[model samples]
Target: MLVQETLEFDTPGRGSTDITRRVTEVVRAAGMTTGLCNVFLQHTSASLMLCENADPDVRRDLEAFMQRLVPDGDPLFVHTTEGPDDMPAHVRSILTGNSLNVPISDGRLALGTWQGIYLWEHRTSRQARRVTLTIHGE
Candidate 1:
């Protein structure tokens, strides 16, 4: 069986939103005993990632690292029509990713302990993002 759904989320700019529970809910609702779940972000400036959820510092540190690695308004970027952070946002998303695939077992996500799914917003302004979940299994 295959199930698919699109979910929308409002991001508060330049941060990560924990979406593990939301994804799990969809997986449970799909009623698939075993399968694979594909979480895909429908934007170029945002990303999907599996990160440590136990400590907020982990995310904070990661954000800091990314900012350092890809600072906004970098003189090297040529795509600045959307502003200084625009190109950088796309760069950040590219460096990270826009999708994730997780195994589903017993009608639940098979994520490891402390591993949580996140919608990482790279833009500096609030934005609405769409994510598509595709489940294939029994």
Candidate 2:
């Protein structure tokens, strides 16, 4: 069996939004006993991640690391049409990636105890993002 769905999320600027529950809901709705789920983000300024859900500090630290690694308004980039965060957002997205593949077991996401899905908004301004999920299995 195969199932596909698109989900939209509104991000409040640069931060991580927990989306594990939403994805799990989709998996459950699909009724796939075992398979693979592919989560694909449809934006260059944002990316998806599976990170530690037990602590917010881990996310904050990750953001800090990204900010330092790819600081906004850095002259190294010239694609500043959307302001300082524009080009950096794309870079961040590339570094983090835009999709995830998780195994489905017993009609649920096979994530670790501390693992959670996140939509990481790289831009500095609020924006709407879309994520498309594709699941296939028996």
Candidate 3:
């Protein structure tokens, strides 16, 4: 069996949103006993990852590191039509990624105790994002 759905939400700007619960809810709603759960972010300026949800500091540090590694208004960037942070956002996405694939077992996500899914928004302004979840299993 296969189930798919699209989630739309507004991001509060540069930060990570813990979306583990929502994703799990979707998986549960699908009622799949076991399969592959694939999540795809429909944006270039935002990315996804599975990280330590137990510590907010981890999220903060990662954001800080990305800002330092890809500062906005860099003279080397040529894609300036969107804004100063535009190109930097894309760079950050490249550094991270745009999708995640997790295994489903016993009707639940097979994530570690401390691990959680996150939507890392790289843009400086509030933006709407879309995520597609595709589940394939029994």
Candidate 4:
């Protein structure tokens, strides 16, 4: 069986958005007992990940690290039409990636105890984003 849905959410800007519950809801709605749940972001400036959800600091620290690693306003970036954050956003997205695939077991996502789904917005301004999920299995 294959089930799919597009999830849209507003980002506060340059941080991680906890999307575990939403993705889990999608998976549950799919009614797949054992299979793969794939989440694909539809934007180049934002991405996804499975990270530690137990601590807020972990999210902040990771975002800080990404900012330092891919600082904005580089002279070499030709894609300046969207401002300094544009190119850096793409870089951050490249680092973190734009999709995730998780296993489903017993009608639930097989995520670790401390792990959860995160939508990392790399842009410095608030923007809307969408992630499409597709579940395939029995």
Q: Among all windows of ten consecutive residues in candidate 1, which has the lowest summed lDDT? A: 105-114
Order candidates by TM-score, high to low.
2, 1, 3, 4
Tens-digit lDDT string for candidate 1 (1-138)? 999999999999999999998899999999999999999999999999999999999999999999999999999999999999999999999999999999999889999999999999999999999999999999
Model 2 Cα lDDT, one tens digit per residue, 37-86 = 99999999999999999999999999999999999999999999989999
User: In the order shown, what is each candidate's alpha-carbon RMSD?
Assistant: 0.5, 0.5, 0.6, 0.8
TM-score of each: 0.99, 0.99, 0.98, 0.97
Q: Which segments of model 2 are wrong by more than 4 Å?
A: none
* lDDT score, candidate 3, position 125: 94
Query: Which wins on TM-score, candidate 3 or candidate 4?
Result: 3
The reply for model 3, stretches above 4 Å from the true place, is none
**Global local distance difference test of model 2:** 0.96
Q: For model 2, how big is the CA root-mean-square deviation?
A: 0.5
lDDT of 4 by residue, 20-110 (tens): 9999998998888999999999999999989998999999999878878888998878998899999999988988899999999999999
Tens-digit lDDT string for candidate 3 (1-138)? 999999987899999998888999999999999999999999999999999988899999998898899999999999988899999999999889999999999999999999999999999999999999999999
Give the TM-score comparing model 4 with the true structure, all chains together: 0.97
Model 1 regions lying over 4 Å from their true place: none
True-structure Cα RMSD, model 1: 0.5
Colliding residue pairs in candidate 1: none
